[model samples]
Target: MAAVSPREERKARLAEAVWRIIAERGITAVSVRTVAAEAGMAVGSLRNLFSTQTGLLEFSAELMVERAAARVTAITPSTDAVAYALAAICELMPLTPETRREFEINIALIAETPAHPGLARIRDHAHTQLLDLFTRIAAMLRGETAAPSPASRTNGRRLLALADGLGLHLLHQRASDDIGWAVDIVRDELHRIKSAAIGD
Candidate 1:
């Protein structure tokens, strides 16, 4: 890969600062000047990188999905289907500080999508990709024998919803250990799919 220039790196830093401020203090804290302050750079310098708040937010939205895509790509599937499914679901959840910030930033971007066509496209793209990801994970859990049935597709959607619910609950400061709740839901569903595949 080509080396990133110093200017590009600074822009990435500003995007990260926007995410951090959003995660801590909501989108209300994310003006261009405030983001520049959070990034410890002059407003003029930040403006040189991004001409407007919309441009900065678009960059932040792109960065948010890029980070999640990288993590999802890095997941090594497990031999045990349930474990594998759980791992995939966890990739979409806010289990760590970085991922938590990611979730927060994505939510903030969602709010802007209505007014910004660019952001709306990004949000729509992410939705489609994540649904495909959930479907693929469901197929993996279904294993080699059976074809993917409509019920299986529905199950995949349900799993995606469950993961989103878990994320929202966690984001709203639910118990730290409530992740177990998510795991239990996935494990139960995967077990049902596995049993069906085996003619149980």
Candidate 2:
């Protein structure tokens, strides 16, 4: 991989500052000046990376999705399909402080989608990427090596909905019990798929 440049690093830090602001003060509080203050930089410096507030918001949302995609890509396949699926899906949720901040930022950007075309495009891309990830997980649950079947596609959509809903729940209700229950639900679904695959 190529080394991260100083300019890119500063932009990422600015994005992090934007997310922190969103997590603490809501989306209305994030501005170039506020983000620069949070990042300990000048507003002009932030503007060098993001010409406008919309650009900053788009970059931050894209960064969050990219991080989640990187996490999913890092997973090594294992024999236990249920465990692996749970792990992969969990990568997209607010399970940790970093991830929680990302989720919060994502939610903030999503709320502004109507005002920002760039954010709307990012949302669409994220939805498609998530469906693709879930489809792969569904195929794994069904013990398939080739293309996903129609049933598998349906199951994938269902799993994505369940996981996304669980993520929203966890965003507001952050508790160990909630996380455990969510994981159990996904595990049960994957197990059911595996059993059905065996029967077939």
Candidate 3:
């Protein structure tokens, strides 16, 4: 892998600071000054990286989406489509510490969307990407090598809803300590979809 440039590293550090603040203190606590303090950087340095708090928030949110997407893309396709689908979908859940932090940041950004209308675009874009991922998974579950059909898209939306619900429940219930339950739920759902497809 190529080395990360100093400027890129600094920006990543600042973005991490933003995520930490959002995860720990909520979105309300995120600001140029606070993020600078969290990152142990000067106010001017943080400003040089991000001119405004919205810019900081947007970058952090974008980075979060990018990281999640990268992880999903890295999964090797499996003959067991159900297992492959579960692996990709589970990356979106807060099952691990890293993913839990990302989930918290995601929730915080969504909650602030009303006040920060700019964030709505990022959220919507991420939603579209996720929907597309689910559609592909739906096609895979049906053993279809062709493009996703309208029915596949519909099923994808349902799968997305299920995933969102599961993530929220896990976050609300603090179920990270026992993530097997969520994993089983997803695995069962995938099997059900596969069975339904085979039946049809």
Model number with the top lDDT: 3
Q: lDDT per model, in order?
A: 0.80, 0.86, 0.89
Per-model TM-score, in order, reads 0.86, 0.94, 0.95
Write down the lDDT that model 1 would get.
0.80
lDDT of 2 by residue, 78-181 (tens): 88888888889878877777776777778888999999999999999999989988988888899889999887888899989988787788877754444677
Candidate 3's TM-score: 0.95
Candidate 1, residue 41: the lDDT equals 99
Which structure among the candidates has the greatest TM-score?
Answer: 3
In candidate 1, position 63 carries an lDDT of 79
Sort by TM-score, top down from the best: 3, 2, 1
Clash totals for all candidate models: 0, 0, 0
In model 3, where is the ten-residue run with the lowest total lDDT?
A: 169-178
Candidate 1 lDDT, tens digit per residue, 78-181? 77778767776777788877676678778888997777788898898888888877877777777744566676677678878878987888888744555666
Compared with the true structure, what per-residue lDDT tens digits does model 3 show for residues 1-200?
69999988898999999998887888888889999999999999988888988888888889889999999999999989998999999999888889877887898899889888889999999999999999999988987889997878888999999988888888877544788988999899888878888877
Candidate 2's C-alpha runs over 4 A off are: 175-178
Clashing pairs in 1: none
